[model samples]
Target: MGANDLAKGPQMRTVIFDLDGTLADTSGDLIAAANACFRGLGLGDLLDARHDAGTALRGGRAMLTLGFSRVDGVDPGEVDRQYPVLLDAYARDINSHTFLYPGTMDAVTRLKSAGYAVGIATNKPEGLAETLMQSLGVRGEFASLIGADTLPVRKPDPEHHFEAVRRAGGDPRKSLLVGDTATDRDTSRNAGVPSVLVTFGPGPHDVRALSPEATIDHFDELDAVVAQLIG
Candidate 1:
């Protein structure tokens, strides 16, 4: 039997979400943190939000490394050394520039009201993820928040997705992941679940080209897409 077939009774349905690029535009704040580190080093804004947004979504070290690459004296070791500092800075001001994509709360509310268990499965660190969600006042909406450090491994590694679904009391085979990167697509594929990629994320990838099960340019289209994919 397929996952839905097995879940014919009262088993919970689930929708797993990616945080940074998918649920919210966290690049501005993320970049601010990296820029803070560079400013401390007297570099004074080595990375520009418009240009390095994709790298920002990739994580702190990626942003730091990209910034260091543009300067003469900096090296990879410097990026490593400043990684924690960036995280600390980001943690302090996590919600300053971060806002949910339009229609996010509406879509999430629809899912919850419809009895689907919602959860986050992001590559962001677990603690940071919790802080961000709480800062945004949406922490209680999700049944679970599984992050990079929540388990021994992260996305594209099926275990991460599986754990998120399980924690939400949903069957993995019946779950769907809403994300905005190739990594998220690969994670869904590896976990044997349908994937939906958002086109509005800061990532430079052509989400449609990622060949996710579905592509949504806006959160307004999410409910129908989720229904078609899993229901």
Candidate 2:
């Protein structure tokens, strides 16, 4: 459908988002860092490893663990050692290949201007989430952000979502979680909020199997999804 078709929809109240593949496409830089870690240890680099990283593109740390796990008998310390290299590489090139998904920034800007509370809730670690948002010039863009380490538990546990809702100053009934992973789906369900799943990321299983409230392949479809949730 055309943009005009979507514009006829009613506005939404509050929308929470996932980072990584859902908002920013960090796979290219993350793949570079993961491979840098592998090459630092004198292992043969596989393009498939990078592609594998695309599926679980939560953050640098998760990518590191996923990439390094391919090497059998590798010590956790070795993985730990590689993390600094990844972090250092990413610190310089975080936005090099990472960008907001199409129409994402526009949607976010419109929502904020419409008086809707906006927040970010992702499985990425709390510290890096804040740092990346600021570094990429979208930090203050979110009224609230909840990362994996933000609380004693993470996604798949509803407390994190509850905390994000509290921070965004919205009731769960008026909020929508937009993400691309089963973990995100579970978080929404457990929090008693609606979720919209995007079909554009690496997830271990089919997103539809998780039973999100809605599913779409583009950010352009988000307005209707959000309208249904927050109406």
Candidate 3:
């Protein structure tokens, strides 16, 4: 059956997470990699984590863009040539300061222990996401991982979340999409699954306006939220 048909069936047994701000605090590595790229090109450091994060591409390309934009001596076209350099640097330093947000691992562990399948759905590239998950020591924990390139389209399309459900071998009617942005909320809505929006990340637009199924301030509240949902 098509992905759209899943949500209408039985309830989901999986919980899919959006990486980066949701599952891991990857800003440090992302920012450091960008700065390193800048220094490598002799442009010096220019972007700050809080502000530059919004400008970075959806994933690795964002880091590449941050670095390329800071290099004063390189031609804009030449930036493409330097992308490989930035990507290599990023992959090498993927988890330098990356860590799970407070209570994230515990929450995931708790969920799995309670028999809920856990997975990841992120805009980050597959390779980078895999590397980060490995570095964080949680690679084997996830039942499925859907990165940006996993499908022809990404978040805000609903397909990605459905694909995540498919990979987890579960139904979406019982699943919840947990993330930190409006695109994620949109994805859940389109997929006809409930979505939980985390407030501790980069949301280029107004999250409240996006109107997720629910909003959370910290990981500590997630368990209670889920309980509320399943009840």
Candidate 4:
């Protein structure tokens, strides 16, 4: 695992989170970085901060691919070429407009106080995830941090989620993933665990259609939902 961090806790169950859309609304900054890359190529802000928010959370490559698709005469390998550029630009202003979802830390505190191990499993790069958590002053809240680049594989793969749960000192059979995307739904399903998708993330309607074990309207509903699913 690259840049993954772990901690031990006495808990039989764990709640792993998907960082981008679930815990934090990082679309603004993500789009900015993607736009920065497009600007460097004289494309001039191919992505709109508000409109392309969903694509932004999908990851840098997706954003680049989308932008490339919109224009004529763009090279096929442009997305790959601009990926590192996007990452560097993103690192420069990772948290400029990023913010934790309402009641996020409060719910996390409740979970931790209630003896549930908490961790994050995200498709964002490991270093970027770590830097954002630290920048938001919430790095200490999670018992484990596993990012896309943390392992050779990522979300929608059972191993990625299992590693996060294991690192947090929780059993995979007793773990649940709280997230906002179909990839998360599949990860939990593949791992033989339940999932709780949040309705507050980008493309909430599509998320609902994925039909995870349950759905939450807000972080305030998380504890109850988690208890029902895994407790």
Off by over 4 Å in 3: 1-12, 54-58, 63-75, 202-206
Off by over 4 Å in 4: 1-11
Which residue ranges in model 1 land beyond 4 Å of their true spot? 1-10
- lDDT for model 2 comes to 0.76
The window of 10 residues in a row where model 1 has the poorest summed lDDT is: 3-12
* lDDT of candidate 2 at residue 83, scale 0 to 100: 70
lDDT of 1 by residue, 42-111 (tens): 9999989888899999999899888888889776699789999999999989888899999998999998
- Maximum-TM-score candidate: 1
**Candidates by lDDT, descending order:** 1, 4, 3, 2
Q: What is the C-alpha lDDT of each candidate?
A: 0.92, 0.76, 0.77, 0.91
**Tens-digit lDDT string for candidate 2 (20-84):** 87888767777776776678778756335345745438656676676667768778777567777
Clashes of each: 0, 1, 5, 0
TM-score of 3: 0.83
- TM-score of decoy 4: 0.94
Q: Which candidate leads the pack in lDDT?
A: 1
Candidate 4 lDDT, 169-219, residue by residue in tens: 898878999999888999999999999999888752567789898998889
TM-score of each model, in listed order: 0.94, 0.82, 0.83, 0.94
Q: Report the candidate with higher TM-score, 2 versus 3.
A: 3
For each candidate in turn, give its C-alpha RMSD to the true structure in angstroms: 2.7, 7.8, 3.5, 4.7
What are the clashing pairs of model 4?
none
In candidate 3 the C-alpha lDDT for residue 152 amounts to 98
